[model samples]
Structures are given as C-alpha cells and as structure tokens.
Target: MSLDDIRGIPTIELPYETIPVTEASAGIQRILSLAYMLVWMQSENLITAQLFGRSPARQLIFLMDETEAHLHPRWQRSILPAILTVLKELELIIDIQLFITTHSPLVLASVEPLFDQEKDKLFLFELNDNQVTLNEITWAKQGDVIGWLTSEVFGLKQARSQEAEQAIEAAQAWMRKDDMNQFPENLRTKEKIHQQLLKLLPGHDPFFPRWIVRMEADD
Candidate 1:
C-alpha cells in the first residue's frame, strides 16, 4: 500500500479506498493504527533477519488497555476475535499472548463461545475490607450482557441509574419492616418511598408488581 501526505496528514491507500487516519471515526482509526503497527513490526523483523542473519522472534505479548474504548457495542463484540484471527494470519507471528482490560459486558459475552477453561483464566480485582485484592474468577457463560452486569464481576444490584437502585433499596427496607436508620429521612415512610419508586422506576419494572401486591395485602 502507498502512503500519501495530504495537508500534512498521512493517508493509507487500500485496495478499495484511501483513508486518512485523522478523518476516520475513533474506533476505525484505532483499528487501522493497530493493524499498521503490527504489519510494520513484521516487516522490520523480516528486514533484520535478511540483513544480519538474525533469528526472527517467535512470540509476541500484546497488552491492550480498555479494549472496548470508543467502539460501538457491535464492534466490541467482534474486536477480540478479530485481533486473534489477524495474528493467526500473520506469517511471522507463531504464538501470541494477549492481556486485555475491558468494562463492557458485551465484550465478555462475545468470548464465551471461544473461552477455553484449560487454556485461559479470568481475573477480578475486588475491594474487600478496604483493601484491593486480586482474585482469579471462574469463567461462566452469562446468557447475555445483562447477566454479566449483575454477575460477581460487575456486582450491580440492578442495571440502572443510581437513583433507581437507592429507591428500590429503600422500598425493600420499608416492605420488610426493617429499621430505616441508613435510608434517607424523606424516604423512610411507606408513602414517600412508594412515590420515589414511581418517580425513578419505569411502570413496567418488575419491582412494581411485588410492591403493589404487598401494599394491597397490607390494606
């Protein structure tokens, strides 16, 4: 491929189209830049081997931080697999070890089909007793992204706004006749908690039916 300097910005000429790295979307730019770097490394290794009779490297360790950054959910789902596929296709690279960090549940879900229990391990950094501890997490197939959000990895009580989670917690405390020392003073009463729930939660939220039925039963 050819490189052209247009207005001081480098552009790559591909078979189908020419793309200026600066003009492309953030996700596209990141992917293009990574691919270019890998190809350049391979070429450099080949030239070194030919010129100096040096042995080519056999293994590569790739460290990627926030693998899902700036990527759309669809792209996040495919990116990890795509990277592995590209490495396999590279003639010079024989083995690859990838260390990737991501907060997107979609990224985890995407790898479920490819995860090998014997070959791979998942790790979690957890806060315990005010100390940050690292633990090796067992890999399980969460049926979907939502499941991942609520799993031990994410530790979300509900996949929703902060207000909704608090409202639901207050409502539960009221329903169970528990002490309200930790809840907001304004939300301690049943009526006030119910109003807060109505304001924060959607009408179709599953919590509504249980709360409403309990209220009716109390009456």
Candidate 2:
C-alpha cells in the first residue's frame, strides 16, 4: 500500500507487522512516520471534541514506546513537537496524559521545551538500571527551549558542536584522499597525509554520496 493509505489507518502494530518501507528508502519512511503521527493526533482531537458534550471527566492516556525506532533523525525531531502540539490543543477538551520512553536524542530535545514554571504538568525521568531519576529542567524560566538545551543540564550545544567539528575534519580528510591520480604530482604527498588522518579518525561516514560530491569538487 502507498504511504497515504498507511497514514489513514488508525492504529499500527509494531514488530509483528512490517513498517511498509525498506531501509533503502529511509527518507520516505521518515515522511510516512510523520504523516501517520499527524493523522493520529487528528483522530485524538476528534475524539476529545465528541467527549466534551458528554463525559468530560474521561481521561485519555497514551503510551508510546521507542517512538523514534523507525524514524530518521529529521523525523525523530518532529515527534516531541507533534506530541506537545496535540497536548496543548486538547488541554481544555480532555484530560490527556502521556507516558513515552525513547532513546533518541531528538525526542528528548523536542520535549525539553514543554516544561512549565507555574505548573508541574511536565516531568522528565532518566532511567538507569531499576532506578529512575527526575531531571529538574528549568526551561519554563529560560524563555526558549534552545537556551535551556544549551544549559548545563542538557549540554546539547557542546555535544552537537563537538560532533560537527569531528564530522568536518573527517570530511576534509576524505576529500584529500578521494582520488590520488586526479591531482598534480606535487599534490600527491597530500594524499599520504590524508591516509594517515583517516587511520587516526575515530568514526566513519557511511553516507558516502554526500562526501562524494566534495571529492569531485576538489578536482
């Protein structure tokens, strides 16, 4: 079935059923996941609208586990925002509660924005072994989610900066060794230096196409 058809389905069972997209089409799968999430949010909105006239005291609790499993980083980034938007939209209509467990950094980054200073409606707990520790994220007082993320509690900025710097250094080294024959004789020594750098590097870029473009440009 097409992605549009999959999005129309109310519920999707995990593990037992195939996600309907292959690893080769990761970008498409990410888009499909987002569409499915939005559709689910709309369904919840409709259900809450109907309950408003009747049993307004009825509580709805949604439990999402490993929400970022099949999603790419780009799509994973959307999960928290979509959830927060749904919660805010349904706040008055229904008493909505959510319990989500995720290992994705993107998911955590998305949720860091929803904390409120006046109300303890949002809580974040980190689990280690059998113990759970709650993190006192002060985003509500910070005014911006990005600001709070860069703060000591989150340290997202430092982590991202380090990762980016390593990536650029690796990319530069890769471009230098991409084609030894294409370069002039005088530049051949640079290729040996690049090979040494590659051995010293800690990580690999499996997405070769993005780096391939830079290799071609160097010629």
Q: Which candidate should be chosen as best, given TM-score against the real structure?
A: 1
Q: Can you tell me which runs of candidate 1 are displaced by over 4 Å?
A: 1-19, 91-93, 126-133
Off by over 4 Å in 2: 1-57, 120-198, 202-219
Q: Write the per-residue lDDT of candidate 1 for residues 1-219, one digit (tens) a residue.
A: 236633566786767888777777888889988998988888887898889987877777888888998999999999998987787687345577778888999889988988889988898888899999989998999989889999999999888898889888888887899998788887888888888888998899989999999877877
Q: For model 2, how does the per-residue alpha-carbon lDDT over 88-178 read when each residue is reduced to its tens digit?
A: 7767666767777665556666655664456544346767798998865544443344454565555564233453434444455456556
Worst 10-residue lDDT window for candidate 1 reads 1-10
Clashing residue pairs, backbone N/CA/C < 3 A, model 1:
none
lDDT of each: 0.85, 0.57
- What is the overall TM-score of model 2 with all chains considered together? 0.40
What TM-score quantifies how close candidate 1 is to the native fold?
Answer: 0.84
TM-score of each: 0.84, 0.40
